[model samples]
Target: MLLESLSPLSGMINLVLVLLSVLTSAFTAAVGVGGGVLMIMALAQVMPAAALIPVHGMVQLGSNVGRTAMTWRHVNRAMLAAFLPGVVLGALAAAWLLVRLPAGVLELSIAAFVLFTCWGPGLPKRALGRGGILIVGAVTTLLSSLVGASGPVVAAFIKQSQEGRLAKVATFSACMLLQHLSKAFVFGVAGFVFRDWLPLMLVMVAAGFVGTWLGLRLLHWLPEHRFDNLFKWALTLLALRLVWLGGQRLAGAG
Candidate 1:
């Protein structure tokens, strides 16, 4: 039964991923972002392309749920309310279009935006308001549907907000929970078989919760100034990685 549930992955590989989920979840919980991007990148190495996004979404949904539950008090309720509509809009748009963009172009676009958001001038207050968050919801969800990890983009946008570290992490996790939830629905409607992957996903999510608990403790210990620097550098590195990937893809295509 265990082997059957894991399907294509061998027992050893399944074990490895479960362990990785804990580490990656902790990293994201402590750092306030980048964990999902790291998780998806690792998944891509071992998972079939067709199963990658949906599986990643399912796992991430669980991880974010853990984080959100632990930090629910810190979430920005008003922002979350605004972002929900966008999630619906974006999911509907993705389901309606059902087209994949050229991966290279999408990667490059996302990378550039992440870099600019990290280093560029801060967005005006107006652009970070309810209207802006709604737009962010739609665009990030659509991009996430295509690319599998829009966490960086969403984190970048949330980084612009004036919320404290805990609030930012909490709210980001809440937003991601919604995005991943929408993703599951979209993929289910498209006829992906999630049941075959359920056992592994369940174990991974449980591991991620353990990691989230540890990470939140670390988050409490870290100095605020250090966290700000770490968060920016972490985003910068992830964006650079995206740039490298995009370049490789375009070059290969050329």
Candidate 2:
């Protein structure tokens, strides 16, 4: 009797998670930050720690890749030319950073990146030189891997590029798609369980399709300058929460 009662509750909980996943994707699409960060909390609450981050990485990657593909032409190619090489450097750094440092440190650093992203009004009105953009890309991606929240950081750079809203989303999405791919490789080498995650992956990817489709339609409707500010603020809170979680873990380790 006890088991059966809990079983019904368990099913309800899972149904809620599935719905939440869809909304999370939609939220990020609308505001320009935080699909994975929200999903992290949801997954951790329901699953073992071992499966939480890495599994979430896979789902997030698929979503970002699809969004980028949808907005491919709008991406600022000049900025990408400056930024993508540094992403490769950042990816190479992920192997060392992921294992040697504590998760708490990574989380805190990532939160800090979001805070930086939040501080600005929405990218510098002043133009960054090509070299500056490249440096920003490498450092941001490196920090993102160490800190583990690449979206806001990437968004900030895209905003700084002043690529306009359409290009902002597209360029940010493309950069993130690459960044996540790097992180995925690192996790794969770390040997997290992927086979068991196939179903969840399918669900998140499908949600991404819906979210991106709706978000693109909505993007046309958003007023200029407003969404950028909103995106930064949203990223700030998400970053702080990750840092707090990391700090707690580090405290426990000590």
Candidate 3:
């Protein structure tokens, strides 16, 4: 019975999803990006009934909070201070103003936005102080609000730092937590059902804890270049897939 419950493709895939949560959480911890975003996409394919943003938001909240706890020493308070205001602004919009965007259209546009961010040549690798941080927070929060999670974008900004693994993880986790908080608040205000999601999120959180541990352990053995390249390709693939999904949704909308 226990072995039956542990299967990855069977009734226990939710459990496996939880494990994926853990692994991706650790991935974010180790590489400073890609926590719930990957898990959310995978879950979307498997759990078609789930509401994408809020469901993933709570899980992400749990994952990043855990990562931040583990890597708290490396957090960049100065950076967070600058970016937070913009995030709050975006959250308010998501909660109050943008509730009715046509589903597929919004997703496709967001997918395109992410692709542009990924392929665009103009983004700065680093920025400091209130101005830079606010811009980062605003842009990332806006994108995240629409698309559930955009760990890669946030990482693009954070990865420019010279901070090593733990620091990168800590600071990135802090930023994501704030973003997820904003999202949860917005979704709650928008009247998405939540009571049922609580139990599922709890499971995902547990999985995220273990996944993060493993990802961190793996990072210790892998060369830095290999890790970076892997993450880069991962984001690229995620963006492309989202773009296709979004486009199909757009076609359906029309």
| Highest-scoring model, TM-score | 1
**Per-residue C-alpha lDDT of model 2 across residues 44-158, encoded as one tens digit per residue:** 7887666666666667788788778888988778877877787778767766564457647766776675676567454444436677777667776666554455666566556
Query: What is the per-residue lDDT of model 3 for residues 1-254, given as tens digits with 9 covering 90 to 100?
Result: 44234323354765677667767787766655655666776877865443777778888888878777776777887877777897898787766665556756655555565555556663454554567778778777876777675676676566554355555566778988999888878777777777755666777788787877776677677777776666556566766776777778778878
Q: What is the C-alpha lDDT of each candidate?
A: 0.90, 0.69, 0.69
lDDT of 2 at 242: 75
For model 1, residues 1-254, the per-residue Cα lDDT tens digits are 56445757888789889999999999999998888988998899988998999999999999999999999999999999999999999999987786666658888888888898889998889989999999999999987886785898889889998468898799999999999999888898888999878888999999999999999999999998888888888899998998999899988888
User: Model 3 Cα displacement at 166 (Å)?
Assistant: 3.6
The deviation in Å at residue 109 for candidate 1 is 1.2
Error of 2 at 69 (Å): 2.1
Misplaced by over 4 Å in model 1 are 1-5
Best by lDDT: 1
Candidate 2, backbone clash total: 1
Q: How accurate locally is residue 9 in candidate 3, as Cα lDDT from 0 to 100?
A: 34
**Residue 135 CA displacement from its true place in model 1, Å:** 0.7
Question: Given candidate 3, what's the lDDT at residue 45?
Answer: 83
Give the better candidate number (1 or 2) by TM-score.
1
